[model samples]
Target chain A: MRQRLMEATVDCLVELGWSGTTTTLVSRRAGVSRGAQLHHFPSKQALVVAAVEHLSDRRRDEMRRSAAHLPEEGRTRGVLEILAAQFVSPVFFAALELWVAARTDAELREAVAPLERRIGRETHAYAVELLGIDESQGDNRQLVQATLDLVRGLGLAASLSDDARRRSAVLDSWAAVLDHELEMP
Target chain B: MRQRLMEATVDCLVELGWSGTTTTLVSRRAGVSRGAQLHHFPSKQALVVAAVEHLSDRRRDEMRRSAAHLPEEGRTRGVLEILAAQFVSPVFFAALELWVAARTDAELREAVAPLERRIGRETHAYAVELLGIDESQGDNRQLVQATLDLVRGLGLAASLSDDARRRSAVLDSWAAVLDHELEMP
Candidate 1:
């Protein structure tokens, strides 16, 4: 029931944004009574933060799974496609709502800050494992992080419009560049 | 007076986020009456959209000025610094507020879509000019676009925390890589 509510909260954020998401609405979407929601998560911030944290875990898991399944041939492009898919997911949209909302809300920022840090660390670790790169190599690590930033920014742009062709081009260009920079397999 | 109101709107967004930006507050900050504010923008959507477009123009002009005045010998690092500064500016945060709000608000998205498109085009053009890269070179252009994506994504991360040291390192690393890929001047 608690997990169900968290998932529903993320859904509400993706569909209604920060302003439109309410504890009452989340309860309705979760098919639970307001009493049940309050019993588990007393406040809207608590619920939303919980939802974001849950999402981060799920997203991290999904990335790991995708990375594991990527075939050797053209795996770089495969990796880019996986990252691109994450950017377009509802979970990304939900997290974006928190990022924007947290900018001005100190309490929300406090709650979200650690979660983002954890997610960032997990993402980099998995990316290194996925690409078969050595994280101990300083320059390679930096380049890997750069690839992440590029894919994330492209994802943000894609949310506004269909930039698939251009995005893919940029991704392929970046993959070639990364191959030389990190000495990737 | 009109400019003041728009500037105030951007200020409010940076300091207060989207929900807290109201016409009354904008007028108060702009030192104008409510009537004056309405007379200029007529609605909050109009005011926010106009402020974003205005910000885009100013940022482009700043990028141009920075490019023209870049000192030789270490111009590469200087250029990255300028881009980084722009990404962390109040204007970027203000525009980010609109982007998140527009995720669920179709009316706001419709108003912002064209302004965002124009800003994106101008940003790419200035980035090319600033880097002294030949856009006719297909590989060079793709890398330039990728650089923009990297910078924007870094900006997004910096907004969450003070990652100045790491960000500068990434900037330097990417600049060296770009010198190899795009043949930067």
Candidate 2:
């Protein structure tokens, strides 16, 4: 029941954002009674935060599963393409919505703060593993981190406008540069 | 009067976010009565939208001035630092608060949509100029754009956690690779 409600919460958040993800709507989407919803999450903040954390975990797993089968040819490009898509996808946008909301909502921010830290740390480890990089090497680690940052920034742009051409251009150039560097060293 | 109100509006946004940025608070901060605030901006939507656009223009001008004097040595790093700073500053945070608020508020989104489009276009052009890159070259343009994307992503991370060390590491790695690439051709 909690899992179902959490999934519904994410769906509501991605489609409706913060304001629209009301308990009523989430209950309806999750097919739970209002009473049941309250029992699981007393406030909207708790519900939304749980949903974001849930989405991140699910996404991390999905990436790991997808990454294992990447094609040998153009592997760098392949990794970048997958990572970029994830960065701009609806779930990431949903998380972005929360991040933005938490900026001004102190209570919500408190709820989200620790979860975000844990998620970020886990994400870095997951990314390092996914990229098959030597995490001990500062340059290698930074390159992967930079790739994530670049993709995230491009994803934010894509959210606002028709920035596909520009986004791809960035990915291509960065991938080329990263490929060259990793190959050299 | 309008300028004062807009400044207060941005202050409220950075500190209080959307839900907390009441017109009354903005008017009080601006040292104007409610009537004057409404006289300048008929509604909260009008007020917040105007403030964000105003901030964008002001920040744009600031970037232009700062960009003109970038040091010759490690020019790319310097440009990226300035830009990354801008992306995480109060004005950017204010704009981010608006972006998140607009996700759930259709009326607010309508007001912000065109302005966001204009701001983004101007930002791209300004970034090109700041980096002293030829606009005609696709590779050069993409590299500049990529830099913006990376910084924006890092800025987003900075907003959430103690990301300074990671952000600089990414910047250093990307700068090295970019320097090598640009120098080669």
Candidate 3:
């Protein structure tokens, strides 16, 4: 029941946005009773924040599982593709809605700030591990960080419109750049 | 009166999220009568959309003027810094609010889509002009686009926290990478 409600909250966020999403709507979509929903989440902010955190954890675990199956050749390009896809997913959109809404809502900001920080640290660490990057070397850490930023921006652009072709081109170009930078002695 | 109202609309957007911003609030902020505010923009969507387009024009012109004053040496780094600053500005935050709002609001999506496309085109053109890149060369165009995406992502990161030091480090690293890439034959 908790998982169902949280999934519905993310769905509301992605389809209805932060403003349009309501607890009643989420309860109906989740097929959970209003009393049950209120029992679990007292407020909309609490519900949505918990939903995003829940989804993010699931997505991270999924990504780690998928990483184990990556093909041997062209691994860098494959990893870039995976990262780019994650940004364009519904969970990312749900999180974006919260991020923008949190900018003005003090309560939401307080709830979201720490979650965002933890997600950032964990994602960066995961990327470093996936690429086998030696951050002690010159600029390696920054380059990996830049790649994440680039994909995020591309994801934002994708949210506005279907720019998959252009996104693919940019990702391919970035993968080449990353491969070369990492190869440096 | 129009300029004042539009500026006030953006102020409301940054200070208030899309759901919180209203035409009444804008009129109060602009010190304009309800009659005058409605005379210019009939609805909140029209008012906010026009406000973003209006401010974007002003910002672009300001950027063009500033470009002329960039120091001769280290021009690439200077240009990167300028680009990064634009993403962190209040105007960008205003635009971001609309972008997220538009994702779920069909009417707003219609209004914001064209303006966003125009801004994307103009910003890309300006970046190319400032960087003096030869697009005929391999991957130069994609590299420029990636740089814009990188800064945008960094801007999003800044929106959450005061990551200025980390942002500066990323920009410096990108400038060096961009310089090396462009130097290739």
Q: What is the DockQ for all candidates, taken in turn? A: 0.79, 0.68, 0.82
TM-score of chain A of each: 0.93, 0.90, 0.96
Model 2 lDDT tens row, B1-185:
88899899999988877777899999999999998778778988888888988888888788778887889898878877777878888888888878777766777777877887787678778766666667665467677778778887887777765567777777777778767765332
Error of 1 at B79 (Å): 2.4
- Per residue, candidate 3 scores C-alpha lDDT tens digits across B1-185 of 89899899889888987888999989998999999888878999999999999999999898989999998788899999889888998899999999988988888899999999999899999998899877768899899889999988988878777689889888888888888787444
Q: What is the per-residue lDDT of model 1 for residues B31-110, given as tens digits with 9 covering 90 to 100?
A: 99998788878999999999888876887787777678798777666777787788888898888888888868889889
State which candidate has the highest lDDT: 3
Q: How many residue pairs clash in all the candidates, one count each?
A: 0, 0, 0
For candidate 1, list the clashing residue pairs, or say none: none
TM-score of each: 0.96, 0.92, 0.97
- Looking at model 3, residue B123 earns an lDDT score of 92
lDDT of each: 0.83, 0.79, 0.89
lDDT of 1 by residue, A8-118 (tens): 999999899999999999999899999988988999999998998888788878777767788888887787788767777888889888877887898889998988888
Q: After aligning candidate 2 to the native by TM-score, how far in Å is the CA of A168 from where it should be?
A: 2.2
DockQ preference between candidates 1 and 2, better one: 1
In model 2, the clashing pairs are none
lDDT (Cα, 0-100) at B10 in candidate 3: 88
Interface Cα RMSD for all candidates?
A: 0.9, 1.7, 0.8
